[model samples]
Every structure is written in C-alpha cells, then in structure tokens.
Target chain A: DAGITQSPRHKVTETGTPVTLRCHQTENHRYMYWYRQDPGHGLRLIHYSYGVKDTDKGEVSDGYSVSRSKTEDFLLTLESATSSQTSVYFCAIRGLGEAFFGQGTRLTVV
Target chain B: QQPVQSPQAVILREGEDAVINCSSSKALYSVHWYRQKHGEAPVFLMILLKGGEQKGHEKISASFNEKKQQSSLYLTASQLSYSGTYFCGTEVQGNTPLVFGKGTRLSVIA
Candidate 1:
C-alpha cells in the first residue's frame, strides 16, 4: 500500500517485439527498483533508479533497459522479447524503513 | 550479490513453528523479509537494519546479524495464511536496491 502501481497487469507479446512496462508511484520515493520473479530464481533485479535521470543496471540487466525521467515514474523495456523473458515483473519503492512492491506485471513471450 | 536461503521448501501443520535462514556473501547493511502468494506480488514483512537488530510482526519475527551477514525469520504457531514463498533481500548499504534470495516456499496445512 505504498501507492505503487504497475501498468499492463498482463501482456502477451511475440518474440522480437518491443515491450515496455511502467511503474508509477505516488509516494515520491527516491529509490525505485525492477525485479523479475521466476520459479527457481525468486526475484532478480533488472534495473533501479535512485533519482530522476539516475539509473543503474542490476544483476539481470541483459536485454532489458530502464529509464526514469520523473520521481514518480520508472519504466522497464524489453528491447526484443524472448521466451526466456516470460515472467512476472515487480516494481518496488524503498521507503524510510521498508520497501513496498507493486501488484506485478505478468509478461509472456510467444 | 544474491543471498542464499536454506530449506528451499517447508510444509507444516497448523500451529507448528518454522524458521527460514538467509545468508549473504557480501557484507549487509539491512535485511528485508517478504512473502508472496502464488500469482501475487510480494508483501513486505519487516526490515532489520544494521547493528544486529531484531523485529517482530505479529507471530512472525526476524533477526539480523550484521557480523555474519545473515538473517533468520521465525514463524511461530503458523497459520494457513502463512503459506507463501518467503524471500529475504539484502542491501549492502542504505538506499541501495536489494538483492533477494531464491526464496523459501512454506505451506501450512490444516
């Protein structure tokens, strides 16, 4: 309940297609993160933003990109979708003492 | 670095007790606990900062040992609601994105 929401709750895109997921937060948090959750790989970080126009790659930042132009919005884009990229993506905002996640986006590449 | 979680999965009867441990190779500044039900986003449970802090959430509690770079979550008298995949996230420093463990699946039966 940290006022975070992920757009496109579910998406099915073809391989090689470009897909972008959006995360919007109303809490005005400085730290925002993107993570993908798979069966055995739990939550793997993809990208994160510390402030407007300031972002960093995460452990699993291959084939994916992120941009944050405003404090309330963070976007994750898959340049070319692949079957391996089919998973649930979560967006989180780090608050003073804890982090809160968005509902999540389920993307499937066919 | 991603933290390693012990007991990949666990099953328990209602009212039973269980503990999940998370260890990180890198030094940690904070440990965060979260639970995710199937097809849902993870919900924050608690966070323990540096200084070897211990915190509780109802019957669920966690202890963080900064010296060993490890954290343990304890669930006492588990209920059916406790059934979910538990993930422990570690941060090397304040305001940094968290790296999560593979997760510990817990199932509580009646």
Candidate 2:
C-alpha cells in the first residue's frame, strides 16, 4: 500500500540475454532498494538509490546493475541472465520508520 | 554480512506462542521484521531502533538488544494466518539498505 509497483510481475528470459526490471513509486521517498529473494538466502540487497542519480552497490551486486534517473523510478538490469540469477526480486521504499515493498518480480532464466 | 536466524522452521498450534531470534556479528543501528506468505511479497511487521526497544502490532511484538546486536520477534496465540516466513533485516545506519537474514519459516495449524 505504499504506492510501489514492480513491472512484469513474472518473466522468463533466456540465459545470456539482457533483462531489466522496473520499480515505480508514487510516495516520493528518498530511499529505494532492490533485493532478490531465494530459497535459503532470503532477501539480499542488489542495489539501492538514495536520490536521483545516486546509487550504491550491495553485497550481491555481481551480475546486476541499477539506475535511478528520477525520484519515482528505479531500474534493475541483469546484463547477462544466468540460472543462478533466477529469483524473486523486490523493490522497497523506506518511509518514516518502516520499509514497504512492491509485489515482487519473479524472474526465471532458462 | 547477513544476520543469522535461529530455528530455520517452526510448527505451532493455534493459540500457541513462538519466538524467532535474529543475530548479527556486526553492530546494528536498527532491526526490521517482515513476514511473507507463500508466493507473496513480504510485508513489514515492525521496526525496533534503540537498545532495549520493544514494539508491538496486535499479538506480535519484537525486542532489540543493541549490545548483543540481535533482535527477537514474539507471537502470542498464533493463528493460521501467521503461517509464513519471517525475516529480520539489519541496518547499520540511517539511509543504508537493510541486510536480511535467511528467514525462519513458521507454520500454524489448527
């Protein structure tokens, strides 16, 4: 209910192909984060943006990239998809004292 | 580093109580709790900031111990709706992305 949405709720891409997932928010929050959830890894941060054009890498930044050109949009791209990259990706906005997440994008690499 | 969660899975009967613990090796500035049902995105439960801080939502509550760099979530009189994977995320400072634990799967049966 934080006005966050992730495009392409589900996707299947070929290995070595490029894929980009979009996260759009209407709350105008300054902090936006991208996380991937796997069976045993839970949610691992992929990348995050603090403001427009300001982004930083997380622990699991390999094979992935992110950009935020506007306050309302954050994008995560997989340069070359791999089977290991298959997971549920969630976009979150930190507001007030809590974090709200988007519905999540389930991506599978074949 | 990712936080460690105890009791990878738990099974509780309706009206029973449960506690899930999350510990981190590094110091923590805050701890956040979230729950995700099967095939759904996680939803924020509550956040605990300061040492000894405790917060509650309905029958679910959590405590943060800064000295130990850990947090614990408690659920009293659990319901079937409480069946989900519980995750605890740790933040080292403000505006930083959270690092989540592996998650504790909880199942409540009638």
- CAPRI quality band, candidate 2: high
Supply candidate 2's per-residue lDDT for A37. Answer: 91
lDDT of 2 at A33: 96
Per-residue CA lDDT of model 1 for A1-110, tens digit only, reads: 68999999999999999999999999999999999988899999999998999999999999999999999999999999999999999999986778899999999999
Regions of candidate 1 where Cα sits further than 4 Å from its true position: none
Stretch of 10 with least lDDT, candidate 2 chain A: A93-102
lDDT score of residue A20 within candidate 2:
99
Residues B19-75, model 1: lDDT tens digits? 999999998989999999988889989999989889999999999988999999999
Residue A40 local lDDT, model 1: 90
